[model samples]
Target: MMTTIAAARSAGATRWTLTSLSLSMLLSSLGTSIANVGLPTLSEAFNAPFQSVQWVVIAYLLAITALIVSVGRLGDITGRRRLLLIGIGLFTLASALCAVAPTLNLLITARALQGLGAAIMMALTLAFVSDAVPKPRIGRAMGMLGTMSAIGTAMGPTLGGLLIYGFGWRAIFLITVPLGLLTGWLAYRWLPADSAKSGARRSGFDVPGTLMLVVMLTAYGLAMTIGRGSFGWLNSALLVFAGVALWMFVSIEKRVASPLIHLEMFRDPDLSACLAMSALVTMVMMATLVVGPFYLSEALELDAVGVGLVMSVGPLGAALTGVPAGRVVDRFGARRMTVSGLAAMVIGCFALSITPAEFGIGGYVVAVAVITSGYALFQTANNTAVMADVIADQRGVISGLLNLSRNLGLVSGAAALGAVFALASRSVGSNLAHPDAIAHGMQTTFAVALMLMGMALVIALRRLKAHGR
Candidate 1:
């Protein structure tokens, strides 16, 4: 009777919500990886140094890291659905700007704007999905979202290659226009208008805290970026600015009525430890991704399409394993899966470190697949654990924090690991363009990755012991 009708409505809502959110996830994640393949093409097109052209990705990541926390808080206050729609619309507009930009500066600026919209959308995704699904099914819903993310990651390089070959680099950005529009329209039609709880009044936005956080992340990101270059003194100054901004952020958060971040959330050892582990895992994983194309192109003498096809294996592995990993987390708990994943990553890194340059594409494909399988397991479990640790009301902020952690990892991995590769290649008396140099640099990078994975494993073990897991 009445109960049956209510159940039917609930099921319909869940299906629509999952579809819309998953599509949004796919679009946003696609943006993260797609532009990577275009970096060299853009450099040649604009007649810019690789260092300057790298800002295309850095600008996007910097904006996301800086604004995610504040945007998440705003979503909580106003409404997640409202923020999501705005984010999608803004992202679509920015993508259009990026496609037609006449100069490197304009393209970078557009990317920054795109990242802002992406942060808003990313910050709301888990919150919105969690709201729609039942508690017991959270793991599965997260799995589905993770699968979409994996698909985007897997497809980005291959798709970018094909588009670039047929059209140009601009086609990469242009492709998103239609997809973004469709995702937005579907979201508007299917998503609940009032997904957020009623009676949650809007508090004053934390303007000072927001500004301080932006300064901190910006300074830190800039320092890391510059540190990768020959500008040592400028990098030092940026680091100092970063330190001061961090102090100001901590001081202001304690006094603000509506803080951008709830500082007290870190008091839970589980949350703090999980965040640290997540950051480390992402750092290693992204470092590998940043360096992989170079190894394929320089060491193995592969073209862009060949490199894309090879790199696709990693995310393909992730896409295949993501759902099962999530279900395993639900059944066996997060700690076991996390530790197992880290161990697998350690093995993968070791394999890459020792692999001979003569092994070529087949070896790399296998190594990357293994590494990304570990990433899939670790991320799905770690994300589930992070969400489970927070209270219902704090989900928005926690989601932001989780995303910020990963974004920081991405920024650091690119800068720090890129520096390592550069230095190691030089030590071999050849630049990265030389096959011998590429081999040395990649080996060094993977060795470093192995150490980081080991560190993560130790952290996970301690976390398990602390929680009596």
Candidate 2:
């Protein structure tokens, strides 16, 4: 009887721990997505152009891109649970600050702080899973986290729209405050306390390597993002500078006794493949966000509300498929599921590209659903493959790298793929572009996206062959 009671208590604690991590994952993804719906309102409120006002979104992405890895390593050095608590607190506080900001600059700065908190939260949530979950169940746990992520993403636009209508744009930021607070409390009350200090803590933090990575990521983000659809001298300079920073970062990492990232880790083909595939897949995933809105609004003549509803369908599909996808990963193994997911994505890409525009929103939504469903599978399997074998001390940094790749992909997709659409439509920034032109843009962009997915498929296949799976 005592054994039964102890076992039940342990099960309950594990459930709560997983719940806490899911909330953190949800909040981090929310921070990434929710602000996008309010961009137009923000532009009007601040009397700013689209270019200037976009900093609201750009700032958050850039902050995550630049800081996620550093924070991951920091979590490894410090205590993950302790730092996660701080991250949740900071995110909540920043959301409140964002709610009250009187100027665009202040709002952007606050968003950056929120992103910092989000970076820490995002990095550590998956890292906690290896500790909280048995190896046999990691795939299911990943899938659950993936579901929360999809829920948060799908919730963002609609929830933001309602909030903006009911209370104002500030409400969008304000809502997260309570959610963040709840997440923080759950994490504090349930997560495993950091193990007593040992070599993990004693290792010196790699300041130089971390700083150089920040510079590299910052430069790359700006390079990919700036100048609207047109690449220019400034973007070129930034890209070159980013390359230099990478070289410097590598040099510093080789010399550092305690590196922010061990270069040797990249030699693991599975790890490297997962990282690369994640970025590529996420870039394609982000194309849905960047291109879907424009296509629905322009080619399909959807009103703002109608467009928002249709846009949510992709993430909704992802949300619905997440747990099932994770189960599939566990049953079939990550390697098989990974390849199968990419194949499904390849089909979705082709469907989206070739589905006649005459079929309208129905066809588009179906294609989006297919793509997102495949993405959920791909993401769950890929994350499982990456995290399944990481050493305990390295889990935090590995998770951070996974997230950083995804963020960079998102940032790139917003720029590069958007540019492809703009050029294909011959519309650039014109809202008045003809419906036919918009339709053509949609097709062209997806065709390019199809090629990107093909690349990812090749990578996954190679990994499978290498493992003789």
Candidate 3:
């Protein structure tokens, strides 16, 4: 066993060696959210409607979600290091294109390409981490990874705001380019170059499964985008697309051997529960990401900068807890940490829900801070649990599924919460600016999220009991 672990390490799996990889992953993850602040700039520069410009964000997410599983599977079959280099190279170039895009359509296209690059980066990073780290230390490594994610998520808007304020929206993309290039250069020097599992292997890509998953996610993302704001719940198209796509997705997963997502992975209580928990936690956490801006702007009567400042609190909480949560997971177990963290989140959300629109900005900031901290704890614990149980070979596929859940949660949070708020607002007086209505919708979403957290608790009870953390 010792020799095998060492050989795996020689296969480019080591804790200290992965510093570059983790940094690389962090930059790529940050790249994903960094564009949010520039959407208005993009709208004005290209003379495009904000609604249409929204697709620029949606397109990247869609592409990444659709391609990540396949890309991860491919990394396993081929080589993780090789894929990482390619992903970084492509992502860097795509950033350049986004910086120089002449039209909204062009920017959207470039962003889509960037998302594809990001998918590869994310998938390979997971696979490589799994290959490099020992089972005993996996929790620590996962904790660091979680910290990076929390930081990136928190900093994207803040960083984007500063860049846009300083040099226009183009600066947002430009900021990433130099860092990406530097990361790429460092990656080429420090990253392992192991040979892939060489073969003209007969098992090819599961085209049907891939296509079905893409269709399902695209339809779902589209439905969320349209259904959340202006599109009514009674829209037949949303229902039809959602139903059909979901059915097809499950069917494809069951039939395909090398399915886009392995169905059997769900059998693991830890994996299923953690994924679900992460999804729920993200939904609740991101509700702030989606709804907080509106609250600050419409309800509190603040500008974009003030709104961004208020929203930054949660990420700050996450950053503070990230490393510590991972350590807790390593020493104790996922069960206690996850439950406690989520409980914090629930409390935070409840507090925020009842906060009067007229409440002081300081009150809002404190609530946001709690939300951020809770999510950070949950994420660190959750990530440690998932990676701890899985074998190295399946790491990419598992990571891809995890990423899929997270993005789905974001889509769901933004859409479902937005729709609820819209309806509640309209029912009262078609005035979305009403704080009471927005708070109502946010609370409802929090309740649903709380239910999901309960489910996660059950999973932890069943799954982690025998594992003996």
Top of the candidates by TM-score:
2
Candidate 2: worst-modelled 10 consecutive residues by lDDT: 425-434
lDDT values for all models? 0.84, 0.90, 0.73
Please give the distance, in angstroms, between residue 136's alpha carbon in candidate 1 and its true position after superposition: 1.9
TM-score, one value per model:
0.92, 0.97, 0.88
TM-score of 2: 0.97
**Candidate 3 regions off by >4 Å?**
1-16, 195-204, 232-239, 249-257, 357-359, 426-429, 435-448, 461-469
Write model 1 residue lDDT over 1-469, tens digit each, in one string. 9999999988997888888898888888888889988998999999999888888988887888988887887877777788889999889999999999999999999999999988988888877766777766667777788889989988987798789989999999999999889989988987877644632657666889989999999998888776345548888899899999999999999998878788988897878887888788888888777789889998999997787778778888989988888788778888888887888898899999999898878888888788888888888778877776456556777888888898888778877777787788889875559999989999998899888888889999898887788
lDDT of 3 by residue, 1-469 (tens): 9999888666563544567667766776787778877788888888888788888888888888778877876666666677778888888899999999888889899999999899988777766665666666666676677677667877998888888888899888888788888878777777666654522332655778877777777777777766336666654586588689779888977887767667777887667777887777777766777767776787678897787777767766776777777777767777777777777777777677667666668878887787777777777677766666666557767877877888888877777766665565566556677766665555555555556556655665565565663
Off by over 4 Å in 2: 198-203, 427-432
**Candidates arranged by TM-score, highest first:** 2, 1, 3
In candidate 3, how many Å is residue 155 off?
A: 2.5
- Steric clash pairs (candidate 3): 13-132, 14-132
Where model 1 places Cα greater than 4 Å from the true spot, the runs are 1-8, 40-52, 102-104, 193-200, 226-231, 431-434
